[model samples]
Every structure is written in structure tokens, then in C-alpha cells.
Target: MDFFAYLTRFYLPFAFFVMGESMQGISIKPGILVLVGNKQLEIIDSVSASKIRARDLTTGEVLLISPGEIEFELKKAAPMSNPNSGQTERTSLIESANEADIELASDRYDVLLPIAGKRPISKKDMIQCTEALKLSASQVYRLLDKLDTNIGPLSLLPQRRGRVKGVKLIEASAEDTIQEIIDQHYDGPGITYQEIFEKVKEQCLAKSIPVPSEATVSNRLRERNPRALMAKKYGSKAASQEFEVRGGKVLPEEPLELIQIDHAEVDCIIVDSEHRQPLIRPWVTLAIDVYTRVILGLYLSLSHPSTMSVALCISHAILPKERWLKLIGMPDGEYPFYGVPKRVHVDNAKEFKSKNLEDSCRKYDIKLTWRPKGVPHNGAHIERYVGTLMTRVHMLPGTTMSSTKNRRHYKSEQHAAMSFSELREWLIREVEIYHKTTHSELKCSPLHKWESHFKSKNGRFSYPSIVDDQKRLLIDFMPFKKRTIGRDGVKLHTIDYYSPTLKRFNIGSRCIARYDPEAINKIWVLPEGEQNYIEIGYADLRLPNATLSEFKRAGAKLRADSKRRVPAAEVFKLIRKNDALVNSAVACTKEMRRMRERKKTRLTDSGHPLNEKNAQQVKMSTSPSPDYSVKPRPYDIEE
Candidate 1:
């Protein structure tokens, strides 16, 4: 076997040092004392490929032996009888050797030595030493001449060949002026050497000083380190792009140890849930496990991603998937991968760095790490996943593709075939399929890998359960604001929220209010030092389906329509009026369509076809629930 192979197969202790020339001729070197069987031997040298020369300690005789024939332990080096004396002797020997070499070289060159309180060497003695050293007479004479000029021993050594000093055509003052001009103009957009040169020439003319040629200034700038120049002129961003430093790769040891979360805009257009008309692409928030490259959880919504989206995605990742799967109409299956990550890597987006997010992570014992700004590769795994998912989305009917050039001549809105609900279901199925398919790097399906991780003995998968109630978790993630309770109610975004319980609190007292952005009909109010929250409903409770975004949109529309700053109360009133009108129109349109369909159906001579009216009456009696189209008031909002 080769020496490396041998070392790999055997465990070598720290004391042993192995040295072998090729694999064939392996043997211990001279001066190493070792034991072979019952014999103690001092290695002399290698005689052949299989034979080693060693002196038998007992017999005091040399012998040749095969290395494989013996098992041995290397004898430890003997300690000095007197450590201080040994150290002193070693120091003295080193000094003596240095002096000897120096004296020999000087004598060979017939050079005069300068020793303190010692007579210099005579010429005859130097000549004799030079002749004894066997150096050529001419060489010795030339060395002596160099020494006579006070040249040091180190000076005699050869040096690398290169220009030690560059030729300077401009004076120091002119060079400084040129450098100043370059520094001043370097950060300017599309700045050129000619511009800086012209500036320098103009300055020289104004000062009545000699100006250097343009070539000289260009050479000076070019000679400067490009990276340093770029940094000095343009900034670190430019320098970083021109000169990149590869960072160490992060490889987590176990699943769920580290997770990366990011937000991406999905590239396909889907119809809105309420309007049932094609809307802009939705933003998707995704969380992925760094170790196994498994997608933990994702959130899809028409609204732009926010801290709430991040929190919701994290909550989904930590919770079990059984409930979510059933809600999405998927077959009975387990999404067993879930746990509170030890560390979460995210970008420096405002939502990622929010105080609430930081506090929540601290509460859960998860360390939050923000990748350095402009370093997208730090979170490359999640970025790549987003890109891969977007590629699949591009294959859908209403894809915007990636860029405008790719989307040229294609109208995504007109080609859209899926509603928001249908798109969500499709995404869910795609995610499931992605979990089952083999990962390019993992060599196994993410689901299979996750299952194996749980089953493995060394996995030590810990199930992280929510510490607080689900409602509390949701409340913690909700957007919070400090407000002073007024005589009327607590107003947020111009919408008044009130509760009978709030009336007990003193007016003008500061309190905390938390509300879901997606559902602004009700908010939870907790007075200062209070342990529980009182639910507060909107003053105009009829607009229970209004969202925070919708309220803001209404306000903006009102302002634009009036061509002036509209009051919050007026905006709220207009929003309700517009919502009522739209709902009434939608209801009337649906009724008209139903009546047209009924008229088209051929009825017998009777008012209805064969007892169909009776059957319809019976069905209506069995299901007497109110129309789900009407917004339901939150009764629990009141005290």
C-alpha cells in the first residue's frame, strides 16, 4: 500500500513522525530507537525496498530486517540531564557558528575586520588565509576592494532585478496637484483621464507653474493599484464589484439548525378574490431549511410582503402541517419537517430588521442574523429556490416571465386563466410535488430526506411547540401602535374603533392597540399595565370586510377625486358608501343572470317542470342559513 493509504488505515499517535520515499521502500530512518518483538534496535538506514539497517541494542551488532516483520514503538527523546546547561551550550554553539562563518568569509576576501578592543588582521595573515581558502586571487582582491568601501556582508547578497525608483517627469508639487484633481473628479459620473488632465493643466496655467504632459499623469494614475484607485474614487461598491473576495460557505450540521427566509414576487397574474378580475402578481414569502434544502413554509398574498408576512411564514414553518393540508383539500399526508430554528439568516430588509421581529426571535430563543448588505450570495439557497419556483410559474398561462424583453408582445392579464383561489391550490400542489421530487444537490427527494432525518439515530430531531396560545402568537405578530383613548373612540388610519370596556378607562390615557392588517374590522386594545386586551369594533360596523389596504386606497382615491386633502372622517364615509354601492350592483347583476337562466329553461304547462318548484322549496327549507355574501358583524368586539 501507498504511504498515504497506510496512514489512512492506521491511527498514528502524535509522537510518531512518518517519512517515506514512494510506497515501495518504507522504513524508519537512522537515529530513531524502536522496539521490534523482543529486540530493541536503533535504526541506521534503509538498505533496500524491504530491508532496513538497524543496530541491535543488546548484541551491539548491525543487522538488516524487513519493516513488516516487526511491530515497534518509537522511543521518546531523552531529556537533558541539566536543561539550563544544555540550553546555554546550544545558544553558544549558534553564536560561535555565526562568528566562524563571518570570519572565514572576511579572511577569504582579505577584508579588514572591525572587532571591539581587538587588533585588525595583518595583510600577510589575510593573504595566507585567502590562499588557504582556495579562492581565486583576482576574486579575493575584488571582494577586499568592496569591503574597503564599507559594504556590509548582507549587501553582497544578490537582489531581484527591477527598477527601485520610477522616473518622475513632474515635480512633487505638480504630482500632488494632479492627485488632488483626480481625487476630486474620480467620483464624478463618466469622468475620464482627459478631463482630469485638462483640470490639472488649467490649474498649472493659473498658478504660472510648469505642467507635465498628459501621458505622465495617465501613467501615474494607471500605476496606482486599481482596487485602491477605484475605492478612493467611486466607493466600496465599485471596488467590491471590480475586486471580489470569496466568502466561506455555510454548511449547517443538522436540519432546522439554520433557516433562511426571504420575499419574492411571483411572476404569474391571477384574478383577485373579491373582484374576480386579473390583478397584479402576488408576493410570496418563503422560509427554507439550510441543511437539507427543504422548504419549510410559504405565504402567498396579493399584498406586498411585510413583517406580518414574515411572522406568518415563520409560524407556519414551526407549526404542524396536518391542519393546513386538510384546508387545502390535499390527501391525508404528513409534513413532518418543523422546528424552531437555532438561527435565522435574512436580508437587511426593513421587515426583517423590525424591532418586533427581533423581539419575537429573542423570545423564541432563535438568533436572527442579517446578511451583509449587497451580499445576495449569503442567502443564495433561498434565492435559488425562488428562481426555480418562478421558472415553473413562467410556464403557467399568465406568466410575466422574468424580464420585459421576454414578456414582449404577451399580455399576461388577458391570458390569465386562474382565479386567486385556483392559483393558491395550484401552488400548494406544486409545493407538494417539489417536496417529493429529487433535489439536484441532495440526491434524494426533500420529503424522503426529511423522513430519513427523523428516523436516523443521530438526527435528534426536537419538536418545537408554540409556548403561548395560538391567539397570543397571532396577536404578538400583529402590528401594534400606542394611542390615547379619546372620548369618542380609538382612531387608526381615520377609522374609529370603540368598545364599552374602553369607556371604563380614563380619557387621554395611553394604551396599546394591535390589529391585523388583513382584517381591520376589529382590534384588540390593552391599556397601560393591563394583562388582557379588550376587543374594539369599528364605529361604522357595517364595513366589516374592509382591510387596512382598502381603507388607505379609499383615502387616496377620495383625496384625488376632491383634488385636495380630504378629512379622515369624509374618507371613511366615502369608503362605506362606495362599498355598499358596489355590493348592491354585484348582487343585482347576479340576480339578473339567475333569472335569465331560469327563463331559458323550458317549463311544462304548470308554472314549473314536474314538481321541481316543490323540490326547490324543500331544499331551501333544509338550508336556511343567511346569505354568506353579507358581511357579518363581530359581536365579540363589544364588551
Candidate 2:
């Protein structure tokens, strides 16, 4: 009998079947941590055929959930196997292999992945792969067999030909002596390979072991990472500069095959619309298509870089720009670039690594990749583009000019004239101009390059898939929360939300909810086992819309005032009051400055009360009001 039948016969209380069929629970094992929406939960135990008990890591609350609630596996548990079995063997093999062997194995694995499991691999494909890997057909088949046994790069590493790995020809003492000499002197400045070889030989002899041949010593010295050796001899910066030039470039064949996203604080200061006074330097997130070098989408905001900025930038990139341009009071057809990219490359910023970004990309089958940590050159294209764009910004009215020395005697704040919305419009117009201007590398405008790629060849034009649901796309990219529905509504961060459609779900059923960071008054809920999302607005409609930051600030103010149980309405009221105070404060400051100016003028006036005594001491004729009635005097009576 199978495992299920054996369990059923032995344990009568265990329910292993549902509807006369074996019902296996989720594949996730107990004790694994999973991300369900924004909460991290550790699985405790399987409770039923379809449910598992878990504990919330943040709140330390225990609850039961189904497989559908899991959004991502934070840590993957290893397979059940013997400690000394295949896992251990593979691990040891990988440890024994060097970096070059592993790189070669990885390349071979990638080449063979296309036809990994195909039976009787076609001669044409086999020949192509063999040619690419520079391997014989029989050797390729052997590697394929090894792959079937162990599906990893370790299985493909080139096997040692003569002596087995870790069974060295030289004695352990001699090997240690060579390594010591190499560490002490081999990487020094002006050291030669012959000198390193001679030193290794001398050390090996001194250790009283049979001296290893010069060839072996030279091979050991060569085995060190060239970059690491260079860094040890010179400096890390010089080594980096030497290796920064890449042999290959990012050359995507299609428009949306590759895209890059990055954030930068704008050089120019922006003012508030009402006050027309300098507010702050705003941040801008830009998304560019690598293939055509076109600016696909951009988001400008006064807030700092965060997951919301990334989500909004992605949303803007995916959705068509016509509606956005119209909303910004620009020509709708100015920017036509829009589509889901096949792969998105970003820096190793926490915002780029957010689970929200991963979920959204996974939902659309888009690949998200990050550059290696501390490797800024991987993002060279975007960085250079940002620099070029900032150069144009330096021409603006309130530009800070990239550095303090460059901005000497330039009062950015006092000269600030453009409002936030006005700056946004200016940026859009500048983007249009950039798209039409010729690029130094491309020798053609970005827009022209984009159009040329889409031009028809053989009656077929290249076009990317357009997003079907714009609102849903935006909601999918926003940060999510998992909460159980209740009789009242969903309470998120002390705010209660309700909608009539929420009545369909069970009282305590957990659901996924996403909120726009710009507006905390509303959220979209994907009810349990439901595909469509229902809109949930504030339970108290009297509360006005406020940003997440504003709400947080209001909550902090209430807590500082020693108020407990701060209601949503009360928090929003404080937000409104704070906003009013900010606006009034600006106006009050302007008025106070004007009043001070008038006071200074009055103090300096010649006819001031304090100066009247000094004026009386002077000649009275000089101080007397020149009588307009004596205007009859002419040049003839000048005497």
C-alpha cells in the first residue's frame, strides 16, 4: 500500500482522505518561515488536510491558515535526506572546485539547460550546443547523464585527470610553507613570478619535504585571483579601475527586453504652488529602455526614495502615457513609450529588493534582477544618463549646480520660482526634447531609434503587450497587508475601512489588501480565494484623504499629547489642522518679514520723532517743506 493507505490503517483518528481521494496538504513543511502579505509567519504544524497552524513573527500570535495565504517562502527548507548522502557529496565537490572550474561548469549548465530532459536530443541542437561549449557529443552526453543524477553545477565540474583533488602531490608541510611564502612576499610591489617561484622552492626545501617542481609552485602562484593580487599590491580602487571596462555590452534586441530604473534627487529646488516659496529639492525616479535608449516613464515627488516611489515608477512605465500626459496638461502623444519589460535591472537598494516589487513582477511574468553589491559599474548606463540629465537641470532658475563650489554665490532658495507642478511639466517637456535630440552614441534621436525598431519588416511590426487593467496593475505593485475581515471592517494602522462588498467574505477570513501610499483613506482588497479586488474606503466618510506620512505624523502628535485610543477621524482632524497651520505659517512668516522691513524703514527715516531734535538743530530752511506755491521762479530770475 502507499503511504496514505498505511497511515489510514494504522491511525484511525487521522483524516488523510477527502471525498474518497487522498488529500495531501501543502508542500510547505513545518518550521519554515513564509511571507503572507506584509507579515512573516513561521509554520508551526499541519492542523488539517488543507490548513496549517502558524505564528506571526511580529505579533507573536498563533493562527491557522491555508496554502493560498502564503505569498513567498522566506527560507527554503532542505530536502529530507541522509547527512552523508548526495547532499554532502555535492557540497564537498563544490568546495573542492576552484572559481574557474565553477564558472566553466555554470556556462556548460546554461548551454545544456535548453535540452536538459529531451530524449534522443536532435542532432542539430546537439551539434549547436556542442559547438557553443566546445565539447564532443559523447562528452556532452556524459555531462547530461551526470546532470540527471545531480542537477547542479557541481555535477558538471571538470573531473581531475590524474591525482584526485585534495590528494596533493606535495606534502602538507611543504604546501603550507609555499602558501606562507606566497602570502608574505609574492604580492609585494615589483615582485616577479620567477622570484615567487624561487621563494616557494626555498621554503619547501627548508620544511625538509621533497621540493615541489618549479612548475607546480608557479601554478599555485597563478591560482590566486588576479584582481585580488592586484588589489593587494596596489589598491582596491586601482584594481577596480583596471577591470571596469567590460568586453560585452547590454544590447537588447527588442524595445522592452531590458529596462533600468534608478532614483535621484533633482538639482533644482521646487516651490509650493500657493506660496511660491522654496519647498525642498524633490526626488525623481526614472525608468529607461536599454534597447532604444528611450525614457519610458518617470515619477517626481517631494518625498524621499521608498518602495512607493519604485511602485509608482513601475506603474508609470507599464501604463500608456496618454492619460498621464493629459493629466499633467501636456500633449498626449509626446511620450508613447510604454510596456512590461522582460527584465528589469536595478541597484541593490532596499526599495528595489522589496517583496512588493517581486510580487508585481512575478504576477506579470517580468524578471527582476539586481546588480551585485558594491559593483556600481553594473548600473553605468543609468548613472551616466542621470548625470547627463542633471547637466540640463543646472540651467534652471533655482539649480543647486551639483556641488557647493559649482554653486558659489548662487542663492538657490531665494531664486526659486517654479512650483512643483510647474517643475513636473518642465521635466516632461525636457524629456520630450531629449527624446528628439540626437544621442552621441546612437547617432540618432531616442525616439527615432524606437520608431525604427518598431518599423515593419516582412509585414510584421514589433509590438509589446499592453496592460489590460491599469488600476489593478497599480494596486498590484503597491505594498500589501494581510488582515482578517470582521463585523466592523478591516483595521489597518488604526484606520478602519468598510465596503458593502466585504459582506460576502467570512468574518475571520484573511484577505490581501493594498493601499496607495499617497492616499491612506482607501485600499483595495483581494478577498480570500477571489480574483477581483474590492475597493474599501474609510468607514467614516467625513475624514478627508491624507497621505501615509501625514497620517503617521498626526498619530505621533496625538501620542505625544498623551492621547490614547486615537480614532481615525480624530487623527485626520489633526492632519487637517496641521496642514492649515503649515499654510498659515508660511503666510504669517511672509507678513512678519514685511512688517520688520517697514519697521527698519521707519527707524531710518529722516523725519522720525527721535531724529526731529537733530533736524531742529540743523538750518531750518534746509528742512522746510519746499513750497510748491513758489513755482513761478524761472531761469531769468535765477539771481
Candidate 3:
């Protein structure tokens, strides 16, 4: 509902802005909140305050608020996961760069080499030399064969067209070639030999100077300066994902030596479309700096939330001001950032494996390290946050559901997923609030520490200038699918997948699969995906737990259910009846026997339990195996 209508219904004294209490029912958890009384407001509860906020209720005027909002806002004791990308940047660095006396750039490397080093070379050393000289890729490979002075006396340069300037190629003493490098913009971005050739041809054609045929002119140039005629294509453009952090004065540390990163999937499942119920939410990617205990980046996405997202999160959260700008090649007014971190802590998620993200770290000399799989404890810091989210936000009553409409009948249903948009917003607000408040993990508010640590009285420490290289971190998509193994193959969302991987796990078993974003030929088995994809494990299936009342009633209805003619119904009835019989008022005497047998059995068959023959002396009372429903009891109501 709109704010006006909501305020009117509540009969609130004054208009108030609600920061994140938009949700209808998030106040089911425990928390102490402030409330107004006959005179003034008062602080409520939370055993022994611990840096958490609580206004001086006795001094301020009473502020009337709903109980639900109070609990929802205050009772928010659960853990939270947020995107790691640093959203803030320094503006002062930009002003400084623009006002700097001179533009910063590496000196041209051409001055370092001898004239003999110029040749058509294609060796690794030659490529390095070309790069060192600030030469283009075309220049690099063209001079490959001429890498060493010992190889040849002359070197090759990539060919290009140019125009004649003063002296014409044909008329000016066939011994020499003359051309002007006109900026046609056609020979590519830089000034090259091609432009001079094109200029020479045009100038000769227009003037009285005799122009030679294209072939004769070319042959003359090649014969006179063959080493400069080596042709090379421009190198193919490629990009990778990266995140950067630099230790202050404070130098960056070695890879993984000082940094480790970890990530987690959000607890709530998100709707595929606002109209449809949520598919399951994928992972929540996070990167942390181990030493500082700072979150480097956080990313929330519906796709599997790959390695790139994690890297992007790290990129968003922190950057080494100078290196980031240098790597990106940004202009003065563009990007600004605070200090970078020394190390990054992460889990085994592939996003951390991003070659692109790694390259970014390498460029800036930042370290990136990851933990092995199945070791949640290793990433305990982030795991603690993820756990809190699961217990508080995800498990909250009437909070998450297939959709808004689904919540209306939520009491009847076991649980529901959340909409993606809603989930994203919740995470952001939660994180922002988390940063605002102090945390147990860092023993202080993250924002307070981060700002205090990096910010100066004048302004924030040097900030990064975003470059194309910095922005080149690739984001990719991997569509989801669901399945279970059937005799014929693995069935995903009713679709059959017959692969060698599935054969090992076999049919009749459900599995989740996602295609690789980089390569379509391979697929990955996941624990869960957005709704349309296969749900992986038992918990992912959203299996409903049997309530205490349901269990009791199911046992009591055994007699009536046994009369059902349907075999399946009858079977359930018999099973229920047996459960009751084992624990019936008449079976109190049998309990003692069952107990003795349970205690005596040291071991049993591979997959089955112990026999229940010892539960009763009556030969007819025997059952083949231990009862699935029965449990040890100290007292028997039957007695």
C-alpha cells in the first residue's frame, strides 16, 4: 500500500519515513523495541546492550510505532550476506589528477634499443621488446624474426598505404621513396608506414611528378628497406575478470600468501518472474580480506552466481587507487577509489578462479586465495553471516514465498521462495544497515573501520580511475535445468539426460545440472537452481517436515485407514497400525523387550536395521527389521 494510506490506517501522529520496513510481515522473531507511553518513550530489551543502538528513551518525546515494525527492525538478530563491491569512491583524487601539472605516462621504450634491433621478428623476446618500446602489437610481431642483432642486418615493419608528399616515388630518382603520413584514419588508430604509402600514391597522382605502378613502387620500397616491409595483423582483443586491493605505503602482498576470499549463496530462493513464483536463488558471492577482516565485495545474482560475480564483487568493494587507474587507463574525471587490501579470502567457488579477475590482481600486485570445498569452517567469518541470514531472514514466517499472493495462504503451505527483486533489495538494505551498526565479526562497524582506516581529514585516500581493463571483468550466464535419474537416463525437470556422468550416479535419483557458460559442451551438477532448474539435494526439494500433531493423528487413524481398498492406502494404514501396535497401550510390556534388543545389537546388515523379534515374546509379534518410526522412551503412556 502507499504511504499515505498506510499512515491514515495506523492513525500515526506524524509522517515517518520507513527505510526498510516495507515488507508486510517481518516481525515474527524476538527483539526488544522502543515504544511511546503516557508521557515519554522508553528502551525495551536485549540483555546488556552491546554497541547496538537504543535512543535515550527517557529524554526524547514518545514516538508511537507498530509492534510489528519494531520487532521486524529490532528483532533482526539473524546473520546477513551482502554484495562486496565497494560502492563509495573518493572525489578529491579526481580533482587532484585534473589539476596535476603534468599527465602521467610511461616513457617511450624506443630510446632504449639499438637501431639493429629493428627487424621482422616473431619470438617471445622480440614481443617483449616491442611492448617495452611502447610499440603496437602489429609492430611487435612484425619485428619478431629480427629479435637479435645476430639474426639479420635488417628488420621488417608492418606494411601500410600512404600518399606522396614532396618527392614522387617514380620521378624522384628511382633510388628513393618519399611519402607523407596523412591521417586517413583508415590505416588504423596510430601513425604507421601504411599511411605514408597511401599519401605517396595520392600525391604522385595529383602532381607533375611521374608516378610508378603500385607493384613497381612497392618493389622499390621493399628492395630499398625490406626489413621495414614485414606485414603483421593486429592482435586479437581479449579480456578477463579481476579485482584489486593494495596494501597502503602499504604495499600489495603476494598472491594467497596474505589474502583469502569466501562466498555463499543467499538463503532465499528468488522468483523467476514477478508474475511466477521464485525459482531458487543461486549463490551470494563474497570476498573478504583475511588480515583486515574486511569484506572486499559482495554480489547477488539469480544465475549460479559464478566466479566472475565474485570477482566483480571484489572489484566493487575495493581498489588500489593508483594501480587500478593505471590498469584501466581512465581520464581525470572518471574513477576514484580508496586504498586496496593486501589479501582476499574466498571459498572454492569458480568465480574466484576467474582468469580475468586474477589478471587484474596480478596487474595491481594484489593477492587472491581460496579455500578447499566442503570446509565451511575455513570460511567461518562469511559462513557466520550466511548462517544468520538462513536462520533469521530465510526462515522467518510469512516472509519468503512463491510470490506476494502466495503469502496470503502461507499458513497452509510449508514454505515459499522469494522474488528476486525483493531478495536483492532486502540484501542491500540489510547490508547497509549491517555496515551502519557494529558487527561481531570485526568487533566494530565495517563502515566505521573502513572509513576511518582509509579516509583522511582532507578527503579519502587516493582513489582509482576506472579503465576499460578494469571494466573488462566478464559477466556470463549459465541457464539452469533440473532432473532425476530414471532407468533410461537422468531426468531433469522431466527432460532426460543420458550422459556418462549421470550413469555413475544412476537413474531414479534426482540431480540438478547447468551448462558451462564458457563452453556449451559440459554441464555441472548443482545443489539447487532458480525454480525451473532441477533441485539437487533433499533440503532443496523443500520436503515438508511432519508436524507433531500430524504424526500423532496419522498413528491414531490407523484402524479406520486399514479398511481402505486401495493397496497404497491400505499399505500406509498397515504401516501406521504397526507403528501404533509397537507403541500401543497394550504393548507397554513389549517396550522393555525392544529396549534390550536394541541395546544388544552391536551391528546389522549393510543397509537394514536389527530384527524386532526380541520386542515381543509372541511369535506372531515379530517384524523383520527395526521400526523407522519408533524411538527410545523413558515412560510409556500404555502402562
The TM-score values for the models, in the order shown, are: 0.53, 0.55, 0.29
How well is each residue in 1-639 modelled by candidate 3, as lDDT tens digits? 343342232222211211223235333222333222322223443333342223333354434344333422321111111111111111222222221111111122122234222222336655566667667766544444222211111112222257633344345532233533222222333545455566666676666466556566454444442222321112112111011222232322321234344555554544433233334444566654443444445555444555435544655555433333232232231222223455565666565666656655665666766665644455666666666555556454334443457445454123444544455446655665655677765578766655565567898663333334332222212333555556655443222335443445544555556532322212345333222332122111212222222334454565366654332233344444544554454433433333222222211111011112222232455455433445646567756
* Candidate 2 per-residue C-alpha lDDT over 1-639 given as tens digits, one digit per residue, 9 for 90 to 100: 343342232222211111111123235888776666766677999989899899887577998998888766643222211223545666576567776777777678668866764555789999999899998999998887665233255568788878775466777887887788778886657888788778877776666678878788787777878888788777787689677566676588878888999999999987655546676787899999987889887987767788878887888888778766654456654888889889999998889998879878999989999998867777777888899889999999999999999999999989988866678788888889989999888899999999888878775667667888877787788888999898888988788999998887889988998886666767888888898989888887767666676688778888889768777777888876755665466355643333322232222223222223434555455564333324456686686
Show model 2 residue runs off by greater than 4 Å: 1-235, 238-243, 458-462, 563-565, 586-639
Q: lDDT rank, highest first? A: 2, 1, 3
- Output the better candidate (2/3) by lDDT: 2
Ten consecutive residues with minimal summed lDDT in candidate 3? 78-87
lDDT tens digits, residue span 1-639, model 1: 343332232221222211212323334678876566766677889999999898876577898888885554332321221225434433343333444444444343233323111123347755664667576656544544443111223222222366534667568888888888877776644678898889999988887779989998898789878887788767777787769786788699877889999998889887544444565677789999988788897777666788778877887777666656654555465466677788999999988888888887887788999999887778989999998899899999889999999999999878977755577677777877888999999899988777776664876654555445545555666678889899888987767888888878899988988876765767888788888778787776545345576678888898788898776667667766765665567444533332222222111111111223434565568764343436767778683
For model 2, what is the alpha-carbon lDDT of residue 44?
94
The CA lDDT at 478 in model 1 is 63
| TM-score for predicted model 2 compared with the true structure | 0.55
lDDT of 2: 0.74
TM-score rank order: 2, 1, 3
- Superposed Cα deviation of residue 356, candidate 1 (Å): 2.5
Pick by lDDT: 1 or 2, better one: 2
